[model samples]
Target: MAGLAGAPADGVAQYRRVVVWRHGQTSWNAAGRFQGQTDIELDEVGRAQAEASARLLAALSPGRVVASDLTRARDTGEALGRLAGLPVTVDLRLRETYAGRWQGLTFAQIDEQFPEEAAGWATGDVTVVPGGGECRLDVAARVCAAVEEHLRGLPENGLLVLATHGGAARVAIASLLGLPHDRWAVMSGLANCNWSMLEEMGPEKATRGLRWRLAAHNAGSLPEPVTVQEG
Candidate 1:
């Protein structure tokens, strides 16, 4: 809210947008393990990715920066907030889906441990939880709530930036697009430090209802592309 000023009087304002970005590369991301609710820190390359994302976002001049309370996401948000000269707001609801017993485990490990459940998940069954993990629907509900809250508080034509994780980002995007939870597979995975922009039009415009349009993804200003090393 710090940088938000001169917002339009109409509920729908031009230039108002919501930008969503996945946090930079993390140790688990490199290793291809499930992060779930586990609080993992970003590796060295992740730090650099965060910095590069910050540089790209600085050019957009977003008004507010919001992020998941998780360390990896918070750290990424902090970097972008500094670049944009805005404060970072941590929102717990923006966290990734809880992986339950699968936390920190790689896909192969999960297959070895809970083959059936892993197979079910791969097939897009929201209720299949190998180990007490949250169902996909549960994640969708929480993410939708958080996004709704964020949208409600936004000033007309204000710009908001959110830093989050892969699972959460996918859920949020799917919900915004009014797509089925199972269709999450259709939405591409966001690259580390990759950013996406969406615009929500107010109730008076032609699109006058809550609608989100994709603006950008995997976009950054880094001189060199950030390479992701598999763990």
Candidate 2:
């Protein structure tokens, strides 16, 4: 409601409402592995989480669904699309930040194998990662760009949904809120199936020229009983 703006002259939708949600939990999540770019499928519980999220969004009745191309996000988006009866568009730019050599490893393992990188990240250094993986700043820039591109195409008053990963989502949130990359460590990871909302305001009211206001941040999963009732 707060993000409503005038439509663009070209009839391309201006900003209205955007919902950002993290994909459901994965097997690797419980196993404490760094799943960046690993392409793991959702486990049984994860699937249930995805279905529940779909039911929740269906109640909200969004106009469009967009998601990262990764398996976890795609699966989640598919479930939501099925429930909401909306088409799902995949965007590779929304994919999770690559962890490089740190992929599939636990925090303890990373600390043991790549001590310097681990320590740098632990200290909130945004530019450091093992091997060639993306830094927090890099992830923020690309994800912000992707969101901007998606928003530019939608009509004003449109409701849109995005399903993505934790790290990239965090970076996007920090960018939206104008927080420094170093603050990424202080922000909590988006829970599995959690939702956040943002609105794009006009230039005059925008804090950063291109106004991106966080309307709802890190909302937890929809209750199963409520979802069933809505369905």
lDDT of the candidates, in the order given: 0.77, 0.79
Query: Top lDDT: which candidate number?
Result: 2
Per-residue accuracy of model 1 over 15-121 as CA lDDT, tens digit each: 55877789988888999998889999999999998997788777767778889999999999999888788899899988988888999899899999998888998
lDDT of 2 by residue, 1-231 (tens): 122222335654456777888998899998999999899988889899999878867776678888999999999999989988888989998899899889999878988998888888877788886547888888888888877787776776777888999888887887877776657677667888887878777666774566777766777543323111353
Q: How accurate locally is residue 27 in candidate 2, as Cα lDDT from 0 to 100?
A: 91
TM-score, model 1 to reference: 0.83
TM-score of each: 0.83, 0.84
List candidate 2 stretches off by more than 4 Å. Answer: 1-15, 207-210, 221-231
Model 1 stretches astray by more than 4 angstroms: 1-15, 201-210, 221-231
Error in Å for residue 67 of model 2: 1.3
Which candidate gets the maximum TM-score versus the true structure?
A: 2
lDDT of 1 at 43: 97
lDDT of 2 at 126: 81
* Candidate 1 C-alpha RMSD relative to the actual structure: 7.9
